[model samples]
Target: MYTTVELVRGSSKLADEKAMSAADVEMYIKKAQARIDARLKKRYRVPLAEPVPDIIESIATDFAAGFAIEKYYSQRPGKEEPYLAEVLIKRAEADLAEVLEEHLLDGLPGVEFLPPPGPAPAVLARPAMQSTTPVRSEMTAALERW
Candidate 1:
Protein backbone atom coordinates (compact mmCIF):
# COMPACT_ATOMS: atom_id res chain seq x y z
CA MET A 1 0.00 0.00 0.00
CA TYR A 2 1.12 3.58 -0.68
CA THR A 3 2.31 5.56 2.33
CA THR A 4 1.34 9.17 3.01
CA VAL A 5 4.74 10.28 1.68
CA GLU A 6 3.97 8.85 -1.76
CA LEU A 7 0.66 10.68 -1.93
CA VAL A 8 2.24 14.03 -1.03
CA ARG A 9 4.86 13.60 -3.69
CA GLY A 10 2.41 12.46 -6.35
CA SER A 11 -0.17 15.25 -6.24
CA SER A 12 1.33 18.47 -4.88
CA LYS A 13 2.67 20.97 -7.36
CA LEU A 14 5.95 22.65 -6.41
CA ALA A 15 4.13 25.90 -5.73
CA ASP A 16 1.54 24.25 -3.48
CA GLU A 17 3.98 22.03 -1.55
CA LYS A 18 4.93 24.73 0.92
CA ALA A 19 1.31 25.13 2.07
CA MET A 20 0.84 21.46 3.03
CA SER A 21 2.76 19.73 5.77
CA ALA A 22 3.15 15.98 6.38
CA ALA A 23 0.74 16.17 9.33
CA ASP A 24 -1.87 17.94 7.20
CA VAL A 25 -1.46 15.31 4.52
CA GLU A 26 -1.88 12.56 7.08
CA MET A 27 -5.23 14.02 8.13
CA TYR A 28 -6.24 14.13 4.53
CA ILE A 29 -5.29 10.45 4.20
CA LYS A 30 -7.58 9.50 7.06
CA LYS A 31 -10.47 11.45 5.56
CA ALA A 32 -9.87 9.93 2.15
CA GLN A 33 -9.73 6.38 3.50
CA ALA A 34 -13.02 6.87 5.35
CA ARG A 35 -14.66 8.23 2.24
CA ILE A 36 -13.31 5.40 0.12
CA ASP A 37 -14.37 2.81 2.65
CA ALA A 38 -17.87 4.22 2.79
CA ARG A 39 -18.13 4.12 -0.97
CA LEU A 40 -16.89 0.53 -1.11
CA LYS A 41 -19.35 -0.61 1.52
CA LYS A 42 -22.18 1.07 -0.36
CA ARG A 43 -21.25 -0.21 -3.81
CA TYR A 44 -19.95 -3.73 -3.17
CA ARG A 45 -21.20 -6.36 -0.80
CA VAL A 46 -17.80 -6.68 0.81
CA PRO A 47 -16.77 -7.11 4.42
CA LEU A 48 -15.16 -3.77 5.19
CA ALA A 49 -15.10 -4.33 8.92
CA GLU A 50 -11.80 -6.00 8.20
CA PRO A 51 -8.66 -4.12 7.21
CA VAL A 52 -8.78 -2.10 4.01
CA PRO A 53 -7.36 -3.91 1.00
CA ASP A 54 -3.91 -2.75 -0.11
CA ILE A 55 -5.11 -1.61 -3.51
CA ILE A 56 -7.87 0.49 -2.02
CA GLU A 57 -5.59 2.10 0.59
CA SER A 58 -3.04 3.03 -2.03
CA ILE A 59 -5.54 4.62 -4.38
CA ALA A 60 -7.27 6.50 -1.57
CA THR A 61 -4.03 7.95 -0.22
CA ASP A 62 -2.99 9.13 -3.64
CA PHE A 63 -6.33 10.87 -4.16
CA ALA A 64 -6.17 12.36 -0.65
CA ALA A 65 -2.80 13.95 -1.30
CA GLY A 66 -4.01 15.54 -4.52
CA PHE A 67 -7.06 16.86 -2.75
CA ALA A 68 -4.96 18.36 0.06
CA ILE A 69 -2.75 20.19 -2.40
CA GLU A 70 -5.79 21.44 -4.26
CA LYS A 71 -7.42 22.68 -1.06
CA TYR A 72 -4.27 24.53 -0.08
CA TYR A 73 -3.89 26.33 -3.39
CA SER A 74 -7.56 27.22 -3.61
CA GLN A 75 -7.45 28.97 -0.24
CA ARG A 76 -4.18 30.82 -0.87
CA PRO A 77 -4.22 34.60 -0.71
CA GLY A 78 -4.37 36.47 -4.07
CA LYS A 79 -5.38 33.35 -5.93
CA GLU A 80 -4.68 33.59 -9.65
CA GLU A 81 -6.59 30.55 -10.93
CA PRO A 82 -9.09 28.76 -8.71
CA TYR A 83 -9.66 26.37 -11.59
CA LEU A 84 -6.29 24.76 -11.04
CA ALA A 85 -7.34 23.38 -7.70
CA GLU A 86 -10.72 22.43 -9.09
CA VAL A 87 -9.06 20.56 -11.89
CA LEU A 88 -6.77 18.67 -9.55
CA ILE A 89 -9.61 17.66 -7.25
CA LYS A 90 -11.80 16.57 -10.15
CA ARG A 91 -9.01 14.50 -11.66
CA ALA A 92 -8.37 12.79 -8.34
CA GLU A 93 -12.05 11.95 -7.98
CA ALA A 94 -12.22 10.55 -11.49
CA ASP A 95 -9.09 8.49 -10.98
CA LEU A 96 -10.50 6.99 -7.82
CA ALA A 97 -13.79 6.14 -9.56
CA GLU A 98 -12.00 4.46 -12.45
CA VAL A 99 -9.82 2.36 -10.19
CA LEU A 100 -12.83 1.34 -8.10
CA GLU A 101 -14.82 0.35 -11.19
CA GLU A 102 -12.02 -1.83 -12.49
CA HIS A 103 -11.52 -3.50 -9.14
CA LEU A 104 -15.26 -4.21 -8.81
CA LEU A 105 -15.43 -5.64 -12.31
CA ASP A 106 -12.58 -7.98 -11.41
CA GLY A 107 -14.49 -9.02 -8.28
CA LEU A 108 -14.48 -8.19 -4.61
CA PRO A 109 -12.65 -10.68 -2.37
CA GLY A 110 -15.32 -11.98 0.03
CA VAL A 111 -18.75 -10.87 -1.09
CA GLU A 112 -20.78 -13.88 -2.20
CA PHE A 113 -24.45 -14.51 -2.71
CA LEU A 114 -26.10 -16.44 0.11
CA PRO A 115 -28.96 -18.90 -0.25
CA PRO A 116 -32.49 -17.49 -0.15
CA PRO A 117 -33.06 -15.65 3.13
CA GLY A 118 -35.87 -17.80 4.59
CA PRO A 119 -36.58 -21.52 4.49
CA ALA A 120 -38.28 -22.93 1.41
CA PRO A 121 -42.03 -23.43 1.69
CA ALA A 122 -43.15 -27.07 1.84
CA VAL A 123 -45.41 -28.36 -0.96
CA LEU A 124 -48.60 -30.18 -0.01
CA ALA A 125 -51.41 -31.88 -1.94
CA ARG A 126 -54.49 -29.69 -2.27
CA PRO A 127 -58.07 -30.71 -1.36
CA ALA A 128 -60.18 -31.93 -4.31
CA MET A 129 -62.87 -29.29 -3.66
CA GLN A 130 -61.55 -25.76 -3.86
CA SER A 131 -63.37 -22.56 -2.97
CA THR A 132 -63.77 -20.06 -5.80
CA THR A 133 -62.76 -16.83 -4.12
CA PRO A 134 -60.79 -13.89 -5.37
CA VAL A 135 -57.67 -12.92 -3.45
CA ARG A 136 -57.23 -9.24 -2.67
CA SER A 137 -55.07 -7.04 -0.46
CA GLU A 138 -56.24 -6.51 3.10
CA MET A 139 -57.06 -2.87 2.32
CA THR A 140 -59.24 -3.87 -0.67
CA ALA A 141 -61.02 -6.55 1.36
CA ALA A 142 -61.76 -4.07 4.15
CA LEU A 143 -63.04 -1.47 1.70
CA GLU A 144 -65.39 -4.04 0.13
CA ARG A 145 -66.75 -4.89 3.57
CA TRP A 146 -67.53 -1.17 4.15
Candidate 2:
Protein backbone atom coordinates (compact mmCIF):
# COMPACT_ATOMS: atom_id res chain seq x y z
CA MET A 1 0.00 0.00 0.00
CA TYR A 2 1.25 3.48 -0.80
CA THR A 3 0.03 4.86 2.54
CA THR A 4 -0.16 3.27 5.94
CA VAL A 5 -2.84 3.35 8.63
CA GLU A 6 -0.51 5.37 10.84
CA LEU A 7 -0.01 7.94 8.13
CA VAL A 8 -3.75 8.15 7.55
CA ARG A 9 -4.31 8.70 11.27
CA GLY A 10 -1.67 11.40 11.44
CA SER A 11 -2.98 13.22 8.39
CA SER A 12 -6.58 13.13 9.50
CA LYS A 13 -8.46 14.77 12.38
CA LEU A 14 -9.08 11.54 14.21
CA ALA A 15 -7.52 12.51 17.52
CA ASP A 16 -8.25 9.33 19.40
CA GLU A 17 -8.08 5.76 18.24
CA LYS A 18 -11.49 5.40 19.83
CA ALA A 19 -13.00 7.67 17.20
CA MET A 20 -12.01 5.34 14.39
CA SER A 21 -10.93 1.76 14.77
CA ALA A 22 -7.51 0.65 13.55
CA ALA A 23 -9.05 -1.91 11.24
CA ASP A 24 -11.25 0.72 9.66
CA VAL A 25 -8.28 2.98 9.11
CA GLU A 26 -6.34 0.15 7.54
CA MET A 27 -9.26 -0.69 5.29
CA TYR A 28 -9.41 2.91 4.14
CA ILE A 29 -5.73 2.91 3.36
CA LYS A 30 -6.05 -0.24 1.29
CA LYS A 31 -9.02 1.17 -0.57
CA ALA A 32 -7.11 4.38 -1.15
CA GLN A 33 -4.18 2.46 -2.58
CA ALA A 34 -6.48 0.49 -4.87
CA ARG A 35 -8.09 3.69 -6.06
CA ILE A 36 -4.69 5.13 -6.80
CA ASP A 37 -3.70 2.04 -8.72
CA ALA A 38 -6.86 2.19 -10.79
CA ARG A 39 -6.25 5.80 -11.68
CA LEU A 40 -2.57 5.32 -12.45
CA LYS A 41 -2.66 1.97 -14.23
CA LYS A 42 -3.48 3.70 -17.52
CA ARG A 43 -0.12 5.48 -17.29
CA TYR A 44 2.07 3.32 -15.07
CA ARG A 45 2.37 -0.23 -13.78
CA VAL A 46 0.56 -0.11 -10.51
CA PRO A 47 0.10 -1.33 -6.98
CA LEU A 48 3.27 0.58 -7.70
CA ALA A 49 5.89 -1.99 -6.57
CA GLU A 50 8.07 -1.20 -3.56
CA PRO A 51 9.58 2.14 -2.56
CA VAL A 52 6.63 3.98 -3.95
CA PRO A 53 6.96 7.60 -5.05
CA ASP A 54 6.59 10.13 -2.22
CA ILE A 55 3.88 12.06 -4.03
CA ILE A 56 1.88 8.88 -4.43
CA GLU A 57 2.15 8.06 -0.76
CA SER A 58 1.06 11.54 0.19
CA ILE A 59 -1.91 11.39 -2.11
CA ALA A 60 -2.97 8.03 -0.74
CA THR A 61 -2.75 9.29 2.80
CA ASP A 62 -4.93 12.20 1.89
CA PHE A 63 -7.48 10.03 0.19
CA ALA A 64 -7.65 7.49 2.98
CA ALA A 65 -7.87 10.11 5.69
CA GLY A 66 -10.56 11.94 3.79
CA PHE A 67 -12.57 8.82 3.27
CA ALA A 68 -12.34 7.85 6.91
CA ILE A 69 -13.34 11.24 8.17
CA GLU A 70 -16.12 11.73 5.69
CA LYS A 71 -17.67 8.38 6.34
CA TYR A 72 -17.12 7.73 10.02
CA TYR A 73 -17.31 11.08 11.72
CA SER A 74 -20.56 11.54 13.64
CA GLN A 75 -20.71 15.28 14.19
CA ARG A 76 -21.68 16.71 10.83
CA PRO A 77 -24.89 18.38 11.89
CA GLY A 78 -23.80 21.96 12.72
CA LYS A 79 -20.22 22.27 11.54
CA GLU A 80 -19.74 25.47 9.60
CA GLU A 81 -16.19 25.19 8.27
CA PRO A 82 -15.42 22.77 5.50
CA TYR A 83 -14.32 19.35 6.67
CA LEU A 84 -10.63 18.70 6.28
CA ALA A 85 -11.70 15.50 4.61
CA GLU A 86 -13.25 17.31 1.65
CA VAL A 87 -10.21 19.50 1.14
CA LEU A 88 -7.83 16.62 1.29
CA ILE A 89 -9.84 14.55 -1.19
CA LYS A 90 -10.27 17.41 -3.64
CA ARG A 91 -6.60 18.37 -3.61
CA ALA A 92 -5.46 14.80 -3.96
CA GLU A 93 -7.83 14.16 -6.85
CA ALA A 94 -6.64 17.29 -8.65
CA ASP A 95 -3.03 16.26 -8.22
CA LEU A 96 -3.80 12.78 -9.42
CA ALA A 97 -5.62 14.14 -12.48
CA GLU A 98 -2.64 16.31 -13.28
CA VAL A 99 -0.35 13.32 -12.96
CA LEU A 100 -2.51 11.43 -15.42
CA GLU A 101 -3.01 14.20 -17.99
CA GLU A 102 0.36 16.01 -17.77
CA HIS A 103 2.77 13.09 -17.91
CA LEU A 104 4.12 13.97 -14.50
CA LEU A 105 5.70 10.54 -13.96
CA ASP A 106 8.03 10.79 -16.97
CA GLY A 107 11.35 10.90 -15.10
CA LEU A 108 10.60 9.23 -11.81
CA PRO A 109 12.47 6.03 -11.01
CA GLY A 110 10.53 2.74 -10.93
CA VAL A 111 7.72 4.40 -12.83
CA GLU A 112 6.89 2.64 -16.08
CA PHE A 113 4.63 4.40 -18.53
CA LEU A 114 2.53 2.32 -20.86
CA PRO A 115 2.20 3.32 -24.48
CA PRO A 116 -1.39 3.82 -25.56
CA PRO A 117 -2.82 0.65 -27.06
CA GLY A 118 -4.01 1.35 -30.58
CA PRO A 119 -5.48 -0.40 -33.58
CA ALA A 120 -3.55 -3.21 -35.23
CA PRO A 121 -1.61 -2.52 -38.44
CA ALA A 122 -3.50 -3.02 -41.66
CA VAL A 123 -1.86 -6.14 -43.16
CA LEU A 124 -2.90 -9.42 -44.67
CA ALA A 125 -3.33 -12.22 -42.12
CA ARG A 126 -2.44 -15.01 -44.55
CA PRO A 127 0.75 -15.73 -46.48
CA ALA A 128 0.92 -15.11 -50.25
CA MET A 129 0.28 -18.16 -52.47
CA GLN A 130 3.31 -19.55 -54.32
CA SER A 131 3.43 -21.50 -57.64
CA THR A 132 -0.09 -20.61 -58.67
CA THR A 133 -1.49 -22.28 -61.81
CA PRO A 134 -1.66 -19.83 -64.77
CA VAL A 135 -5.14 -18.74 -65.95
CA ARG A 136 -5.92 -20.35 -69.32
CA SER A 137 -7.90 -18.18 -71.81
CA GLU A 138 -10.18 -19.82 -74.43
CA MET A 139 -7.53 -19.06 -77.14
CA THR A 140 -4.77 -20.58 -74.95
CA ALA A 141 -6.93 -23.66 -74.28
CA ALA A 142 -7.57 -24.09 -78.04
CA LEU A 143 -3.85 -23.63 -78.76
CA GLU A 144 -2.95 -26.16 -76.13
CA ARG A 145 -5.43 -28.63 -77.61
CA TRP A 146 -3.96 -27.97 -81.13
- The C-alpha lDDT values of all candidates are 0.58, 0.82
Candidate 1: worst-modelled 10 consecutive residues by lDDT: 105-114
Root-mean-square deviation of Cα positions for candidate 1 versus the true structure, in angstroms: 7.2
Worst lDDT run of 10 residues, candidate 2, spans 73-82
Give the per-residue Cα lDDT of candidate 1 at 60: 63
For model 1, the superposed segments whose C-alpha errors exceed 4 Å read: 14-18, 43-58, 77-82, 100-146
Candidate that would win on TM-score = 2
Best by lDDT: 2
Deviation from native of the Cα of residue 96 in model 2, angstroms: 0.3
Runs of candidate 2 exceeding 4 Å displacement: 74-76, 80-82, 115-146
Q: What is the TM-score of each candidate against the true structure?
A: 0.50, 0.73
In candidate 1, what are the lDDT values of residues 11-78, reduced to their tens digit?
Answer: 55533446667667777777776666566564554434345555565566556765675667665675
